[model samples]
Target: MYSSLLMILGALVVGYMIPVKHPSALLTIRRLSSWMLYLILFLMGYGLAFIDNLSQNIIQLFSQSAVLVSLLLTFNLSALYFVGRYLAMPAAEPIHKKAITSLRCLKNLRCLSRC
Candidate 1:
């Protein structure tokens, strides 16, 4: 985790130093961001792969009560999503309206392309 933090910090520093007019700099940032996204996804997949073992551990800790386990898990996930939305710090309402409009345009273009 510390290594990942250091790597992110390094990337941010390098990204800040790169000249905006240089095409290669922007490309490098894009590639780095994509790789970082893939790495995170892989890590999440790895963790998810062990869910069965984790569930067993939870059962042991909770005395094999599935209902209690399900409720706890549901609440945890709900809390996470709510907190994430709260922390998203969305732009003002008008900007969001504009974004929605642009997204609708993009969807229309996609539909047209498909047709």
Candidate 2:
């Protein structure tokens, strides 16, 4: 953890030192940053792959736990939305109308390919 923190601090310092006005310097930094991101992603994938290649029982347990947690989160959010709507019963109509108009405008813009 300390080493990771140090690495992050070093990256921040290096990133801060890069010039923004020079086009080639900016482009080179952007490319290098993207490569670093890809490398980090690859390392994470490699670690997860090792965990996945472990015994089937461990993998199954993790999968089941993940699904259960996701379902709980979904239900909790749905319940909260319903309760909030009920408590704010007077404001729902105006909010709903505003949301509908905004959505319609967004849809029309998409249809016209303006964005």
Candidate 3:
């Protein structure tokens, strides 16, 4: 575990040395990284196919996934609602008025799961 943490920290230090000099190149890299991340995740799912008890646990796996999805959806909607309510209050900070931020966050999550 410590080795993995040290490796990640080293990678982070190396990553900071690379410069995003152009907006277009930065945007391209961001899009490419997102796609690559999805590819990595899809590849990871292949391990699930080889599980010894997959046939028996398929339903349990799906049920747990459904439960997790419901919990996340509930939290997202609740946050959007409360944030909207907070924005309506007179004392709300100008920063809080970045209201579409929650929607964008949800969109990013949905893209990861669906795209």
Candidate 4:
């Protein structure tokens, strides 16, 4: 696995160092690689379907995964809700909004992220 990964990274480094004069050929290769990836995934799925033990446990696996995912989403949303409520709660009235530097920093951060 390490050797394969090294080979792939080596290929990427070689490819990056080499400049292609005709971008059209590079575009074609990119499209071909995308299709090859889909084909590989399809074949992998098809192969896995033939495994007897996995077929038997598929339902249980799916159920466990679904429950885990739902719990994760629920907890995340609950935390988000609590955090939002805390943020929104009325605080001791400030003389002006200018008193909070954090709010202005967050606005600047938002602007930078968009850029």
Candidate 5:
């Protein structure tokens, strides 16, 4: 277990050290990571489904999961709030809006009303 954890940390360090500059390579990495995460979650659910007395413990399991999610959200939000307050980040500029004229729509190949 310890060796496994050490190896995981080493991999993380190596991943951090390697810089991925290409957009296509980054996108491929992102897609692969997402699929891997989905597979892991599916396997976890599959394992849980085979556990004995799972039906009887469903409510307890849900409540525990809810509490855990709530705690994590609260902590994360509070931390972000404090850090943002300290940073005093500038507010985003409002987008400039223009009237959608028929001529503009013709040029853009999109018409809000009947073309």
Candidate 6:
């Protein structure tokens, strides 16, 4: 467990230290990381399937997970509701409907003509 934690932390530190300048490289890394996450989740489910009395324990797990999820949702929603209510945030226009700034419009027109 400690070794796993250390390796994960080391990789995280290395990731921060390395500079990825290319957009394509960043997209490739993101795709690979997502695949790795999916694989890990698949393997965990596979391992769980082989555990003894999992059928019996599954009910308990479901109930516990349901309760946990409900509590998390309730608390998060209530907090967000209270925050939104207390904070007098103005309703803003939708992004697509909002007027483009003169600088941005110039940049867009230049790019369209040149590129």
How far off is residue 41 in model 1, in Å? 1.7
* C-alpha TM-score for every candidate: 0.33, 0.39, 0.51, 0.37, 0.57, 0.58
**lDDT, residue 38, candidate 3:** 91
Backbone clashes for every candidate come to: 0, 0, 0, 0, 0, 0
lDDT, candidate 5, 35-81, per-residue tens: 97799689879989898998899999899999999999999999999
Poorest stretch of ten by lDDT in candidate 3: 92-101
For residues 1-115, write the lDDT of model 2, one tens digit per residue.
5998799899899969865898898898889989998998998679767774467667786898999999999999999999998876564444543333656767687644433
Residue pairs in candidate 2 whose N, alpha carbon or C atoms collide under 3 angstroms: none
For model 4, the superposed segments whose C-alpha errors exceed 4 Å read 1-18, 57-115
| lDDT value, candidate 2, whole model | 0.79
Per-residue lDDT tens digits for candidate 3, residues 38-105, read: 98578669877788888899999899999999999999999999998877657755675544465676
Q: Could you arrange the candidates by TM-score from highest to lowest?
A: 6, 5, 3, 2, 4, 1
Question: Which residue segments of model 1 deviate by more than 4 Å?
Answer: 47-52, 56-115
User: Could you tell which candidate, 2 or 4, scores higher by TM-score?
Assistant: 2
Estimate, for each residue in 1-115, the C-alpha lDDT of model 4 and write its tens digit: 5986798789879979988778899999899879977996898689778878996789997999999999999999999999998877677776763444665667787645434
- Which residue segments of model 2 deviate by more than 4 Å? 18-20, 52-115
Candidate No. with top TM-score: 6
TM-score of 6: 0.58
Residue 115, candidate 6: alpha-carbon lDDT: 38
Candidate 6, 1-115: lDDT as tens digits: 5987798789989999999999999999999989988997898789888989998999998999999999999999999999989985899867876555766767788645433
- List model 1 lDDT by residue over 30-73, tens digit each: 89889988998999779768777786676575675777889899
In order, the Cα lDDT scores of the candidates are 0.78, 0.79, 0.80, 0.82, 0.87, 0.87
